[model samples]
Target chain A: MSLSEFELIQRYFAEASTDASVALGIGDDCAVLSVPTGQQLAVSIDSLVQGTHFLEGTPADLLASRLFGSALSDLAAMGATPAWLTLALTLPEPDEDWLQLFSSRLAQLCNEYHVSLVGGDTTKGPLTLSAQVHGFLPRDHRLTRAGAKVGDLICVSGCLGDSRGGLDGLLNGFENHTEAGYLLERFYAPTPRIELGKILLGKANSCIDISDGLLSDLSHILKASGGLGARLQLEAVPISSQLIATFGEESARQWALTGGEDFELCFTLPPNYLALLSQLPVPVAVIGKVTDRADIELFLRGEPCQIQGSGYDHFQRKDD
Target chain B: MSLSEFELIQRYFAEASTDASVALGIGDDCAVLSVPTGQQLAVSIDSLVQGTHFLEGTPADLLASRLFGSALSDLAAMGATPAWLTLALTLPEPDEDWLQLFSSRLAQLCNEYHVSLVGGDTTKGPLTLSAQVHGFLPRDHRLTRAGAKVGDLICVSGCLGDSRGGLDGLLNGFENHTEAGYLLERFYAPTPRIELGKILLGKANSCIDISDGLLSDLSHILKASGGLGARLQLEAVPISSQLIATFGEESARQWALTGGEDFELCFTLPPNYLALLSQLPVPVAVIGKVTDRADIELFLRGEPCQIQGSGYDHFQRKDD
Candidate 1:
């Protein structure tokens, strides 16, 4: 028997609520939530189409995790505490095994992040997934891309390029390589640094998630921060050892610079707060410094170098 | 020139902030909002994919209005005041004229409903429009499907079957009929009864939006209210003159019972609350009474009649 949309939601998505703030969850027209007093509600939305965002044969569980992580990364950039999520899932056909795996991983992530699945629509169509994540933070403490200032130190949490390396491996049939497993995992299950976001709330002047590569995402920060630029130290950029082992240093470095979907938080900190870096739980590297000029510059081994192309442009032709 | 995602958003979506509650709007990882004190937040998401929820050639303005109305209807059912919305719009290709019309109508609706467009994503893919609406209401006064009692009077706001008639006209190429215009309007631009939802908050025992026909949607209220049933007075069901004129009385009546997407509010109220109906701004028909039995019964001309089908099921075969 073909699975009905209602049945799919009931069997796979609906679960007993443990969240006190979620007055109503799935099965309601709208989920009712209690926003804490004196806190600002932060909301972001992202949609991933099958071919554009993921390969057709991507594991359902990995897709679920990646979608969730990507959406939650926005909250992390905003320094918001994860609270509630709504998913709009469109599928061409109902597959019971796929739904089971997707929902289980989704539920697990929700639990880990303390976000309740509120309400959403499930329809039969092309494979597409859209997630709206809501979080909360004090009004004055929330981080934004508009707050960067000249002389502020630009930093990034954790290694980059691993996800892009994984994508390259997947597309080029390099899965058999020993180091490809870790790279693939990074691509499929990139973590949202929610804790780090909260920690950087008052400290970071500007913040953004590295989804469209470090250059592209950081350009957003620069643009939003009112004509600021950056002088990036090439060697200071963090690239995973697995990425280097699989694809070599030069290619891995290129991926770190221009390949997107890292899901790492890039933030700007004032010079005075540099001393507090030792206290953070995660390894953060100051790879660059915000500059007064409006043109981004790169330095390799203390010598200037010209970057060939900008990061991923959604509308750019593949051959361009 | 092809439209880039950033350009698309900047040209059509990003607008000057007029809502004070929206601390941050577009051009950010997350939109920050201030929820009112002593109020609970309500959230709902809906996605309309091409060929499934709408015809491919539907007017962009009409599609925008319909999608917004449908999503806002959920908030109306929850007795929440519309506050913020985020739209994730995926398109196969960019059309300037279509986007202009769509964004203008969407902006107009947002202004009319006092909602702020927050943050969303636009990507290249199959046409899919997903909207997430957030609203707020006092915790104790919100409506839910599970609140109805056995003796509650069942009522619905506005006329029914018009949207279905409109849909039929569109699908069957009978849109040239004089009355078809009105029916088509009903289908393409159904008004979300936000005002009525707020007014019914304390008076109504339970409530829901009539999306999947009166019978199917009301059944949800009954099922959620714990095995309750309803005795619907068929002759009392409100059918629009446009629908009856275009599709005849019997077809119109049948559509009223089983045609979906009316976007009207259906609610259950206690016996004494009937007097308050006179004060409501919109005409509400008391079509039935909630019953203890677990089977919905229909009465036409004071005689029981069997209903052939419930409503549109997403997974059901077309010939079923």
Candidate 2:
């Protein structure tokens, strides 16, 4: 059965979801919206295409959840509250089951975060999904990746490398109720640290959500602040015991150092917020300290461990 | 040569073409902007692909001009002035010549319309361009396709069907500076009637930009505004004699009824505004009148001629 673009939109995406801020929604040529007073709107768009970003036969629910979760995490980095989002779906053919599961999960996630679906575009083409999320941050209190100073504590909420490990485990057709499997779940349904981000609004001087691993995203803060360096204690870095038990210490270390898509908040704070961070809902690990000299050093008990690549660079060749 | 996505963006994009409204532009996670007071921001977006919208070997300058013109025409439909635009380009590979030509032409068009480059995304992928344009309209006045009344005079701005003739000539490879060539130029570089949209704000009760030919786009206005029918005088419509000489009356009539990229304004107004509209900068043709039936009737020498199809309906096969 073949579907034209118009019929495809009506069947899969014609339901224009409602949000308070959307003065006018889909069905119109363009969306009309208003930014709340004393707040600035922050928008980020992420596009995921079949084969390009995800494996074939990936669950619709997981794809919906993780893609949006990763994108919303960008707003979390800037201390922005989720508002509304528009989805652009280009699919090879209309799949009713896929649309049903994807929309159900997306709608549920939006409800959980107090976010709303405002608009979307559906067309016939290769399977691609582009989600544009709009959020708002306070006028005077926005977090940026450009304010980390020397001696600031480099803190990250939540564990790392589970998503990559989970992918490996899933690809290997291995599953267990053990801690390793739990780490794999963390990879599949990585949580966006929205609460931790808002909590650090006044306290965190600089922040970024750890999407592309700890060291790489943290380096963004360092590079932006200029001439800044960081000293990371390998022992202080938190790793899930499941990751340690299954992958062993060395592989887990590799995961911890270079694991991508963790979606944790890596932030910097002055000494004054140290005690406050200890009382937070999520785990806050002080893995490093900002330095004056421009060299990011990793120490395992005062001995320099060899540092190579951490996290995935989009431009880096896999074979290389 | 296969290129990484990040390298593609940095090389072709990341230029940050500067203009006044771009306080903070591309390279950031989100674009920060300021909306001026006393004007409502008008926004619209359009996506064009190589085969989907235009020919593969079309001139890069002409492609840029047509793509931006299509989006800017939406602002004209809403009676708004052009302000800022963002382009998301997805390309198969790096083409230095294409980039240089496309960018220069796009820049010239942006400057001519007084639109500033704000933000965009560039990725290595298929050859596709998606552009979102924004502008400012008077706070209270927005020309919409839903305000026509029963007794209003149906007026259209500029000559129609030139684009269709041009397209026909292009397909046939008939190259001479004939009337059809001029019409095709109109199709390629549609002069968005921004000033005319503004001038017809309150005077024209209902309005739409005629990209999809007259009878079809006007049908949209009628459907939205709860209209019955339209009585169009075939001879009253403004048509270039060049079109009449080249395509003859029948094909010229076909062009006027089905040309799908003219970007002219089709609007309805009370007869009282005839005196006022006559004083405007451009020509206005009072070609039709609203009727009481739910059927459109065309009269040539008081003889009925039925138009079976709407302008380029997505579901129907186009003649071209």
Candidate 3:
């Protein structure tokens, strides 16, 4: 059935939000929300295009999962509580099956993340989805990229670059069933470190998400922190065993250091806050230290190392 | 030179904001903002595609102005104060000239509206732009579509159908110099009725923006207000003299009734609140009245009349 914009929204996106913070949701020209008193609002917007961000025939459910997973990761990096999201989706035409799967997965994710889908606009064009997320943070507290100081310890949560390995395996085909399944799952449903981000809110000096690889994302933190530098012990970077077994340790380590789309948290802590690291709900590794020097130095097993590529750039990809 | 996303944002979008509500602008995982206490937050997102929304080879500056003007009209409809915006822009390639024009016009509009360009994401794809705007409203007050009662007077701010006339002139070419210029200007740069909306905040019973022709948009307000109907006096519908001279009386009336993209405000007020209409800064026409009937009735000079088209729908345009 060819659905009008109003009918489409009424059918799929008119789920009433029970959250008290949402004074108004879908159906209005603008969504009205209540940001709790004594809290600042944090917002982030990201877009995913058909060919640029995903394969052409990627399943609608997996695409929704990955899109929202990556977008919400920004909120996770900020130590903010994800509260609401607005989606602007463009499609070449209305496909019932695709809309069903996409909206269902998106609704599921919103429920899982405790965020209400507040508003959306659907248009006709090439397949592209943009999501703007709104969240809340304590007014006095901030977890930013500019706070990492010299002598601070740099850390990352969970495994890095498994999503990259998954992409590679999906492209080249994997030999091991168990490893391929694990890698693909990670790629399709990468978790954002929201809890860990909140835990580090007051303690972590600076924070960023590992979307553009550990090296590149960490460089952003360093650069934002007044041209500071970092010394990363390559051996300390976390790599999943599945990724290492599927693609050898060398390839896995390279991906962990430079592959993009992991959605894990990379943050800095003052040496005194080391105790909080052990109390984290998720596994974390101290991979480096912030330095006064002006360049990022890499060490593998205590020996200086060099890598071939940096993180992905939208306009100028390293591989391109 | 091909620019990375970070460099593009830093060069074009990193204007320092004097707005105190913006706690942090570009150069971070997310934009941090402070919504004043005792106020509710209002958010709206809109997407414009190259082929669907505007003609190919449209000037970058004009395109930017039109996109923002149409999007901010949502905030105006809600009677909210526009405060911040996040842009997710996708481009096939980085064209310095296009970027300069687009970003410059965008900056000008942000300054004009007192809204900050807080954060943005630049990606590689077919040209598509999505903007999410955040604004603020008094917690206890609202001007919504669902509150219009049967006896309310329906009024509209500014002339209608001039943008449609402009579009027609653009496509078919116009003869009158002054009228053509006025219509083309209207088509290219729509002014969102923000100040008028704020004035209507608690006083007006219900309000909506005229994006998709008067008939279509007012129908939305009527439908949302529990299926109430309206009686529109066709002669009273405001049509600019320029549009009438250019398109003739019948065609101009039809366009005034159904043309989209005008970005004016259509609101309803109880009869007791009619005095506020004359006091409005902009010229307003009381074109209709809400009624208990379930169907819209049109009359011209006290005689029943019929119009050809209703309004614009994104998925199924009437002209299409």
Candidate 4:
């Protein structure tokens, strides 16, 4: 256990300050920030646990990136430009290397997005992290998950579920040159689609990032819009070629449909804005459409099929 | 320990409706918010741990209120209007009654402040809570701790050390109500001085909320404003008359000097605004003045006395 909380914060949580927009950073009671004028701020918070969120010996930098990426996914969903973040970390003990890796990666992410580390809390307990992020959205341009019309096209950025496949490999020590390992890396270091989010602010109707499986996460958009459901085209759901080569079709399908932690944007757009959506800096592929049916479903070549068991139900489970 | 993470959030966290200004509330990857035009947002986060910050078996509603008040004090210090908040709660199990009490008090706080509970995380683990709050500030006036200048009058709202006295009574179970019991209640249900904060926003040059002991927290103002110190009148440090009567002058004085957890506002006003400060709504008593000496001193009838230790240092004796 850490000897003291103050030392723990200094050692494990304080990131190197370079171009931090924070008027006052951590070490104070609260972090103070100056937001740019004419911009509305988007805010989100997420917590990740050790045994549950990651494997026992996961790389610290990778874990840091993945957690931040998960929270950043919310900004992307809102089409908000990244701004600043605060962290609350509870740990079992102080580890020097872990702190170094975590801080370095945090600094890297902050620099990449021009965001700053504003404030945080560090405590000694079970290892867990909760991050609260702030971002800027233009007036009347904040993307939401509630505006998807029935005819709007459903789109997803990047492939989904390779992170789960990677975890399977990590647990079973399965190795494949195909995309599972690559997808795992993708899962671990998802590049937050900041630019794409900015472009879709007003262009997209309803938006969400797929951290859970597609059906589970996309259901949020459907429910938010007061829409009945969406019909996801299984074949059209993007899967990395590497994932296909390694996990094979059946396993890849399982991962894509049910496995989660991809941190990809799963959003809806008006059909008329297809050109605009296609022109986004990141690849955005339409794979489904909102429908009047209340029952969310998956269609494989126009035939109804079960959606890999509600796509990661916390109350339900698959026996490995 | 718990069944699943989603169930935890759904059961303990998911509100039927944020039903407030939450453009998009919980259940999405991130919560989307709308910032009213022309108003800047103030943000702060604080995490509390069991056995470190509070004793086990603390009243659930009191815990929730205390934690919320801690964050509110930050907003109060910033002279910001309350807006939205997110909570990250980790626990060993789902105690139904505890959740009921906690959520109830949380709802009360939200409704009282006109703030919405936007997003949060609930997980099974050792007990910890991180509350992140966002508030709005007026265009060019943010009362920062760094704005105090020479000849500024230092002032505080509400009495000090009551909470510390209360916590001591609770922890050691010193049931004699002669005075400690009131102190304990004061600590448990601290008033965040929101009204006082707004009243002083324009009149005060520098400001901070005293969560740590007054002497230590006030030092933040001094340090922020170039290490300019002040001489505080021992008599002027507010203490409840009942406390002095019950515990006698010596113990109450000790508590006033080094005990903490009082979420009161401490601010500085230039002499030019001194008359204006005196006319403010709350009793904003000028207890001291900024001085050239770089070390804080306490005066009891013109006799200089040593303050034994830093206020609220958890690991060391305050008088050591």
| Top candidate (lDDT) | 3
C-alpha RMSD by candidate, in order: 2.4, 4.3, 2.3, 4.2
DockQ for all candidate structures vs. native: 0.60, 0.25, 0.62, 0.34
List model 1 lDDT by residue over B200-276, tens digit each.
99889999998888998998999999989989989999988777777788888988988989999999999998899
Residue B233, candidate 3: alpha-carbon lDDT: 96
- Residue clash pairs of candidate 3: none
Model 4 lDDT tens row, B1-320: 12234334345434544544566666555666766656666778877888777888888898888889888888888888888888888766667777778877877777788777777777656678889988877665678888888788888877777787777677665546777657766877777777778878887889988866788878878987888899888888888786676566787788887777788888988788766765666666677888878878888877888766657654443334
**On residues A1-320, what C-alpha lDDT tens digit does candidate 3 reach at each position?**
01255345435545547788999888888989999889999999999998788878889999889988898999999999999988888988768788888888888888788988888888889999899988899996879998999999999999987898888887778756678878888898889788988888999999999888888888888889999999999989999998888888888988998898999999999999888888899999999999999889999989998997878777676354
DockQ of 2: 0.25
lDDT for predicted candidate 4 compared with the true structure: 0.74
Q: In candidate 2, what are the lDDT values of residues B11-84, reduced to their tens digit?
A: 44334346544444554445555555555556665666555456678887888888888778878887888877
lDDT of all predictions, in order shown?
A: 0.85, 0.71, 0.86, 0.74
Q: Each candidate's fnat, in order? A: 0.81, 0.10, 0.82, 0.43
Question: In candidate 2, what are the lDDT values of residues A12-109, reduced to their tens digit?
Answer: 43334455565555544445566666665566666665554567788888888877887788778877788776665655556777777887787678
Better of 3 and 4 by lDDT: 3
Off by over 4 Å in 2: A1-20, A56-63, A93-104, A166-190, A241-252, A279-281, A315-320, B1-23, B38-40, B57-60, B94-98, B138-140, B162-172, B175-188, B237-249, B313-320
Task: Quote the TM-score that chain A achieves in each candidate.
Answer: 0.95, 0.91, 0.95, 0.90
Question: What's the true lDDT of residue B32 in model 4?
Answer: 65
Compute each candidate's TM-score over C-alphas: 0.96, 0.85, 0.96, 0.87
Q: Give interface RMSD for all predictions.
A: 3.5, 4.8, 3.2, 4.0
Comparing 2 with 3 on TM-score, the higher-scoring candidate is 3
